[model samples]
Target: MTDQPAPTDVPTIRTLVRLAVPAVIVGVVSALVLFALDWIADIVDKGIWTALPKAIGVDPASGWWIFGVLSITGLAVGLVVWLVPGHGGPDSATTELIEPPLKLAVLPSLALVTVLALAGGVSLGPENPIIAINTALLVALVARLWPAVPSQLIVLITAAGTIGALFGTPVAAALVFTGVVAALKTGGALWDRLFLPLVAAAAGSLTMTLLQHPKFTVPMPAYTTTHPIDILSGLIIGVIATLIGLVAVYVFPLVHRLFHSIGNPVIYITLGGMVLGVLGAIGGPITLFKGLSQMSELIQNRATYSSGQLALILVVKLVALVIAASAGFRGGRIFPSVFIGAAVGVLANALVPSVPMAVAVGCAILGVTLVIARDGWIAIFLGVAVTGSIAVLPLLCLVILPTWLMVSRTPEMRITLPAPAKDPQTPSTPASPSPGA
Candidate 1:
């Protein structure tokens, strides 16, 4: 399959406008699919964490209950990977946020595992799997319907649509796609190339807003003033969180290798789940899941936690995120990293009361996200978005410079497997390990 759209020689505006119709379909359908998957996951989450516990007369918050549930959830997901078709697509730890479209057949199993991870309180998010599912489905459908359209272009529009839906804003899609489009060597007005993808993004974003209106921000105090000391605080917090994230990044491959050594998804994933349960029990309910709602809770109750308590929560969540990602869980790392960043920010504020809450949070998030995603646009966007403040943007923009410097040369949170043995007639290539191997 082609990696990108066939180079265009300045297509007319009319052609671009014509493509907008399909882009809208791509966007709307992607958003609806994302919403449906998330809805199912939420129901399952409530059932396991609430209904089951209540029926059994066990406190969901108890250490034993938390540990037992997570262990079983891991075993259940392991069975899916072991027995399901497509093996739940590729290993998420070895894949980028947006990769080549998967085979259509892999989408269902991939979606199933993703929903299980989300509901099972796995410390990962829906970004990677959902985007892959949308890309595969849309590319197949759009290519068949409009045989003239390049498959690569369909992939771009589909990814843009899902990202818009995931973040509840077309702007996030735009920011992400800018870097992607800039890398292509083509001869056309940049905006001309971007027009269709933006159309899809806007449609997807609007659809998600109408359906759920997902919000990333918490109830943090407003960031109104721009003080000189605030910049220093932002830089310090950003740098520290970036370092913490880098540690996890370096450790990721080792953890992944350790789990893969078990050679059985059932055993390793269960062990990972048990570890998560222990961490959850120690960190309490606030430290579990993908970290979106949990981050909000942490921020709202920042006053209740001392610096020591916040630090413990931060370490636990960061470690939990690493374990979940390394153990073949079918989810993304961005969500949990945001929670880690928030924890760092709140902890910083607790230690030093003078820094603005929003600044600390934004800068810390900016640092941690940059380290994990290695995407400056996304890291900066998340930092600003999570605080719900524009005033912190300038500080984050500055803080990211130093944080990026520190993390730029570090290895990413991904593994590089050994090359597979090839026959004389077959091309030798390396294959990524699937979750639970």
Candidate 2:
């Protein structure tokens, strides 16, 4: 028989179709899951917020109940983590970096998050679970449909889409995802490949908007400042923020160890809740949850609390967050942390009348610093974006630069991914023949 000619290696339209189709399906399904999670979380949070107050004979509307809710939340979260295997969902961001994309069986993670939110009396935000479940579902579906797709690419796409949709801005999501992906060694030509996936994700997000009519919002804070003052304050605030960021980095690991080391995670978590409750009792309910509600309240009525009260709330919230996070409760620390920073900034402004602008600017700077130091720019963007303050941008940017610079100087911050292993029997190393041969 005559030898047959080999097929050309060039990619055909059919090949592209096969590849893109799976990704598109994955993207759409992921978006749907994310939307559903967010919807459900919203409904549940509102219900809990309403019912808890009535059940306990405390007005949910009053700041006093913040402690009660947070204590209960912490206790409940502790119980769930102790009882459930794998505690809650896997660490979404960490897993995305270190692990392969796996199946979407994240009920444990979701359950943990829901319970934590309910028990800890923190803010009811779906951003964390939404990202986890969405990415998990997308990666799982894509892997099943196209087994040949690279796992890292799956992680990148899912991260990009989830972040993009949640933020209501693909650009912001892209910046965060690109930074994360670069860290994960999924860069180079992969950036080129991201274009299609990003577009698909943006489309999916748009679809979500059409169905739900969700509004895209960013905080814009106004501050009065001469050029010299703004520049000088920005520099000073940035340095302070950077130092705060380093403290946060050290704080996280220490807190994580402390909470986890105590006997019986459930007990520890409940105790954490109790601690939060006590703090809340002293600081007012403003110290509870993720601080979204409090943030809104603070922005609207900055004068509601005395400077001392704001300072106390800031301290208590920080402690409560560390306790809740370390005790195996599920949720993102970003919102609560930012809220604490803002509270501190407001207090600083009140205490030092000369630097009235410093309150808003300091909050953004400190919040962004802590975020970048611990979780990177997504946290910074979130802190800045939610403030509804635009005049702080130039100052915020200036502050962020020094914070990044300071963090870069730290040995822990200069993390490098471990290189992949090469085969033992390469051209550089001669292989031995089998004894039988």
Candidate 3:
């Protein structure tokens, strides 16, 4: 019997180079595409709102009658999704979890999502789609460019690039990608090869940021609380946030089924837009689009929304997100989830009166942690960072431990298993002799 060459004899460096270069290219391209979409969406959002007053003969800067702006935006989103190729929008975490990744479809997928966000009038966010599409594109590009690259390496580079672009920091991106790759069980060796692509993606993201400043820039906050009780508040909020996270997971699958069962994704998506439009009409213009700017406004003007209004917005926004997401619309849940968390925290503060602001911070942290389990630190960073309150980090850290515990306990957390390679030499069962034979 002839012996086949051992797998150990396979070349590794050659494989790594073949995978890393194209992965970087894909990451760079996807980042540029995402940035352009974001810029265009910003222009469209501002332009429509700006024109609303002029068209109706109202003052543009007054910010009153902004409901009209929301409705128009919702209609635009509906139209785009209805006519777009991917129907509803680009692939998201939800989609990635459900469907196999497609490389060449990134651009169209991105376009669909950009349009969906424009129309849905949902206070969602962008990071999810940006990551999903970029990852898929980079992975696809690497496979196409280097047919010899291992599948595992391709997955790592895609993951790294996607994460790198999102944070505009390769280190953080690498951490996120590593965590996700680990969760997906793609293996550890790919991480070593991911270094170059990670660097390239971070550079690409930084370049994009320099060219067109992002509205949501992370800032360091000043910490002030020295009290033990305040530190304890973090633990309390983290527990509460973990509870909310559980609820989000329970609700997500139902939402997914509901939309898919509706038969036609486009119709449901358009309906989702209409529903969002009505919500916008009733809830005010803040209910529309990715809530990046609104989240900033909320943090800056903490008193702008009354406790009751904040609570209402949280519920409405959550529902809108489930609908938009389930109905085939694309966008990230991270930002919307964050907005909900913040609102919940604010409402908790108003109700309890005695709970420190740190408790609310924990609430935000837990809410995001439950929905997104991969990088709990990012959620912690966001909850504290967005508040622009450094005094809360100690409390935020307290919440992180329990929130992690709670998510780790959840049984339904999505886990992606690696595909088993086909065995070419495995003997096929001999077919029965044909009747003619």
Candidate 1: residue pairs that collide? none
Models ranked on lDDT: 1, 3, 2
TM-score of each: 0.94, 0.76, 0.75
Model 3 spans > 4 angstroms off = 1-27, 58-93, 97-100, 103-106, 139-152, 181-194, 215-221, 349-359, 387-394, 411-437
lDDT tens digits by residue: candidate 2, 1-437? 01211111222335444555555655566567666655665666666677766786867745456656666676666666666554666532232222344444556556556645744465333455555666566666665766666544555556556655655556655655555544434223544434545655675566666666553232334555436666665566556545654665557666666755787866776776776677767666566666766766765577677887777776777676665555555555556656766665666566665664443545454544354334446545654566544555556656666566666656341123455688787555212111000
lDDT of each: 0.87, 0.55, 0.56
Question: What are the root-mean-square deviations of the candidates from the true structure over C-alphas?
Answer: 4.5, 7.6, 7.8
The C-alpha local distance difference test score for the whole of candidate 3 amounts to 0.56
**Evaluation by lDDT, superior candidate among 1 and 3:** 1
- The alpha-carbon lDDT assigned to residue 348 of candidate 3 equals 69
lDDT of 3 by residue, 1-437 (tens): 02211222222454445444565675677568667766777676565666545777876333334444444444555555566555434435244421335545445746665644754355556666665555566556656665555444444455555555555556556545444434443233654434555755576667666766553432323346647765555566566656765676677667666755666545555565666666665666565566666655655565667888877877776666665555555666666766667666766666765666545644565556455544665676666546656666666666676677667756452323354686999775322111000
lDDT against true structure, model 1:
0.87
Error of 2 at 104 (Å): 4.3
